[model samples]
Target: MTQVALTISAEADLIRVRQVLRARCQRVGLGLVDETKLITAGSELARNILTHAVGSRGGVRVEDVARSGRQGVKATFFDEGPGIPDVDQALVDGFSTSGSQGIGLPGSKRLVDEMTITTEVGSGTVVEIVKWRRDRSWRP
Candidate 1:
């Protein structure tokens, strides 16, 4: 089940995107902590898109995925910016090409159950993040 899909052109639109994601996650019975993590991860990725790919547009997609007969929330952020040249270095903590705190990739990886990055120089970047439903708890 896909819940939220949004595109942001302005940096200010990123906040609204995050809010929509958080609300959609909560409505689906994802834990509060999980919702926060999703929003934070989305914010970081969206911010990167805005700062690096300004004047371009990007979006976040929220989906419900089934695994081992269970379901979970899956979120993806995509941008059509100058793709990362070095994916290995890009994943390292504090290794930003930009003069900013470099926790976007690694930090987002830690927040989600799984993450995957795909990019091509002069093309774009796509980051997919997933958080599986934990059987130990059910919000609904």
Candidate 2:
């Protein structure tokens, strides 16, 4: 298992996150489509950290994982900013506290195989997402 952690303190870090995620996804043997999905999701989350968590500590950890002979990539985004007051509402398609398109969280979830968010009103938030490589041998 390989792991890399990067801090998201500026706009440039978002690009770095995408680059690292893309490399890790390719190393895990994920195809172009899956890699794109994961990188998009990671970019959204990393941007969130920069946009919403400014002046606070935020970052993402990307790791290569394997389970049941399946290869996958996992990313965990964390921040020490004001946490989401309403997680359910935040997950809604059109809910936005910052007045943007409000698709970051929900859209990101759709791009990954699994996603989970843990947050507190005052403490902070942690979002973990995983995308598993498609098994080429499977047939309908």
Candidate 3:
């Protein structure tokens, strides 16, 4: 496994986080479409870390993983800000507290293979997502 951490505290940090995720995904041999999906998901999540998790304090842990002969990229994010009060609503598409079309969490979920999130209303939030490598013969 290869891991890197990129801060998600500012708009500029979004670029860094996306860069790290893109690189990690490429290193894991993700295809063009997969790379786009991963970067898009990472962008949405990193943006949320800045917007929702007020004060824009948080970071994303990016990694290239190999387990049981399957390889993938994983992104784990954490923020010490007022967390989502309703995780369910947060996961629902078209739900947004900030009111900007509300597609981040749900959209990201569709782009990745697995996702898990934990949050506390007054404490913080954590989200982890993974996209596994696809078989070369059938990938497009």
Candidate 4:
């Protein structure tokens, strides 16, 4: 497994995060559409780190992963900020604590194959997302 880690300290870091994810997605044999989806989702999460976790320890880790003979890419966004109070409410499309469009979390979830959020009220939040390549030879 190959991994890349980067700090989310400024707006510039968001760009870097996207670039890293794009590269990893390609490395994992993801198609252009898959790459776009993963990169878009990554950008949203990186932005969340900057917008919601200002002055906190925030970072992103992207890596290549495989499961059941399938190749995929995974990105994990973490921050030591005021954790989410209500995860279900936060996932709602129109929900926002900072007066934004409130689509980051939900939109990202739709873009990835799997997404998981681990958060505590006062501790922090960690969101992990994965996108698997569609195998042409596999059928369910």
lDDT of 1 by residue, 75-105 (tens): 7888888988999999899998889889988
Model 2, stretches more than 4 Å misplaced? Answer: 136-140
Model 3 weakest 10-residue run by lDDT = 131-140
Candidate order, TM-score descending: 4, 2, 3, 1
In model 1, pairs of residues that clash are none
Instruction: Tell me how candidate 4 scores on lDDT.
Output: 0.91
| Model 4, residue 72: C-alpha shift (Å) | 0.4
Residues 49-83, model 2: lDDT tens digits: 88888799999999987778787899999999899
Which wins on TM-score, candidate 2 or candidate 3?
2
Query: What are the RMSDs of all candidates, in order?
Result: 1.8, 2.9, 2.7, 2.8
lDDT of 4 by residue, 43-99 (tens): 999999899887899999899887888988999999999999999999999899999
The per-model lDDT (C-alpha) reads: 0.80, 0.91, 0.85, 0.91
lDDT of 3: 0.85
Per-residue lDDT of 29 in model 1: 71
Where is model 1 poorest over a 10-residue stretch in terms of lDDT? 131-140
Model 2: which ten-residue window has the lowest total lDDT? 131-140
lDDT of 2: 0.91
Off by over 4 Å in 4: 136-140
